[model samples]
Target: MGIARQLVHRLEQWFELMGAEYAYMATDRSNEASLRLFTGRCGYSKFRTPSLLVHPVHSHRLRAPRRATVVRLGARDAERLYRSRLAHVEFFPADIGAVLGNALSRGTFLATVGGYEWGGVDRFLACPPASWAVASAWDCGGVFRLQVRGASRLRRAAAAATRALDRAAKWLRVPSVPDFFRPFAGWFVYGLAGSGGRDAAMAAEAVFASIVNMARGRAAAVAVEVAAMDPLRGRIPHWRRLSCTEDLWCMKRLGAGGGGHADGWDWARSAPGQSIFVDPREV
Candidate 1:
């Protein structure tokens, strides 16, 4: 086996020891070798497409509205906001627990209005403070979910929360929130966004604005890996500004691939399979 294949084997073994159900990796669609390595010998089945959005610390330009409030999120409130997010979207049963755990972790912020939680943004902040924060807003625009409860109005709430973050970013003058997470400085926003409701499109736009504003407040630049083909989506009339960094692929292993479901299938006896892979970064 080649070096890459050996490395993948080692990784698979390590993850298996950690009780991983299946292992997967993401690579740009333009990278034919990586595509082959994962699909050919790694035993990952293509599942769905996912996109990555990135914002640099210097490209932020949107301005926050005149008035807004910013507050740090407490653990309890953060958990509540996380639960609310879970209620709004559909997540894979296998990945829900891990996702929730990460969301409620320390690197999260909740945006509220009129003393009520309106939207929450969570990011993974660790070393490389420059890439410190990669956040996602719960409600952007008028749409949040199919069944939103309580007094929080989607669009208005989202706008208020977004504006607050923008203001914070401006006060920090870092050019990007994610960059703040890095110790040495210079990072950007990277993650995914999806909306489900009557005003999904509008919500998406608000998400974009909020993201840009947050970046600009830090004096940073933003790059989005958009799945939408609509001309109105993203920075509007400037789609090329964002470059494609990687193509996320959904890889699935059939019939008890791992995670306590592997008893029924015999990996040694089955024939290897292949499927047409598509870029997940589109949406």
Candidate 2:
């Protein structure tokens, strides 16, 4: 039975009843049938294409440079930072505080390199470091399970062997592969932002490494989504083998609207921005 079309219609009706102005859905670019269903039949237009960057969690801890200070932000402080620094970024959520405060949320963190004191948000923002980066960690494992499909026997055996070796030798710090064959949880990085410069890139790399290190044991891996043109893309550390270069997001106006825009500004048609806020709930 062709239920997808009917489901889309019902969802749109529900959206309208909920006073939603728009609705969007994401799918892999290679999903031809999904693309056709949403774009041709459901009237959803092509929208944002962001890359999903993933890094495997290692058994060892990765530390930021001695000069850099990593701060774990409280929900209120994290909300303040996002509202002030990322308000204009695409897909910035209004209930960020709620998201940050969710049980599944690991924490929000900021990495900075300088001789500054943590007086509070005001002091940090007032005298921001030359290279600073912020990110939030969401424990996706608690929400749902993910399994990797179609892996060959050899790959699985190799992964198992590597994991065994790492377990046998704890001092080696071997990069063990996750058991993708089984349902496992992974950490999702959201609200990634940073300043501009080589130092900023280093700081971002440190932040990503730190997240991966922190996620070990609890999560099999850590992943983050960013726009192609996002400045932080080149800075964040990820494995080319594990990351997706492009993930498609399609959007449609639920109510009578002018090209999915209120004042002649379509989000789908807008140019790619430097930064993006990847909401874990949506991911």
Candidate 3:
């Protein structure tokens, strides 16, 4: 605790000199020590808790792949797309040029159909008024795998019970993941979206299926993050009923505020698991 406070103080001083407006950090509820240090000493406040959902690519999750006119763009084109289409998205980087310039953004993709196209994000009100979901895989084969493998004995046992129940559900012809939960390497479908009635959504789905096929043997799973309120949340396929952690966002406003307090921030009052968002590059 003492060490963290010192480190945070130093970082705050550094950022202040750099003329940064605010500093952000996130921690799950289970991390009591981290929460205390940031809130108690660092002068940060609770902003919001968003559900982080992941979709693992597998045979079962391979729903019908619709065919849409999809194009993989170059760095310059992707950067242009981010700049032109994603300005109003909440939590989006103000300087997308910096983000696109970062080495982490391996590639950019765009999907178009039915006279509509989505380059960066698919925003919706509470839920998308339309329908579409994307599929891809990531080469994230280490920590993500470790998380599930390193579960406690009790936690593993609970998973076993769930597996048995899953089998029973499948026997009754109900929707269930009969294979338990197996994982592999995969790609990610980030900033995938669509609009303008059924055809457009279907086209987006087709494009996603095509990507999934490309990742079939080369990757273990693809992961994407969506807010709970995102209409596409229900449409995106994934390991059904999967458990995930919720990260509570904490932030401190610089010189412009009341000792960097963030209690009254609009994002703080948002419903947990709602409006979860992630840039594909951060996937």
Ranking by TM-score: 2, 3, 1
Q: In model 3, what lDDT does residue 125 have? A: 29
Instruction: Decide which is better by TM-score, 2 or 3.
Output: 2
Q: Give a tens-digit lDDT track for model 2, residues 1-283.
A: 2699999989889988998878889898999999999999888888888999998876666555676677888999999988998999888999998899999998888888766567789887787778888899999998899999999999999999888887888688777787878999999999988885766666677678778888988988899998877776786777899999868989887766536555787665667777778889986
Q: What lDDT does candidate 1 reach at residue 66? A: 21
Q: Residue-wise lDDT of candidate 3 within 136-229, one digit each (tens)?
A: 2334442243233555677667756654564455344323222223444445555554454555456555555555545554554455665545
Error of 3 at 144 (Å): 9.6
Best lDDT among the predictions, by candidate number: 2
Q: What lDDT tens digits, residue by residue, belong to model 1 across residues 1-283?
A: 9999899877777876787655556567777787788877776655334344444433335443222223444544444444443333223123333433443222233222222233433331111111111124321111211222353455546645554575567554433223222222212222232232223333344444455555343333344443424222343212233445356554534334343233755332333221111211212
lDDT against the true structure, per candidate, is 0.39, 0.83, 0.53
Clashes of 1: 38
Worst 10 residues of 1 by lDDT: 124-133
The CA lDDT at 27 in model 2 is 91
lDDT of 1: 0.39
TM-score against native, each model: 0.48, 0.90, 0.61
Count of backbone clashes, every candidate in sequence: 38, 0, 18
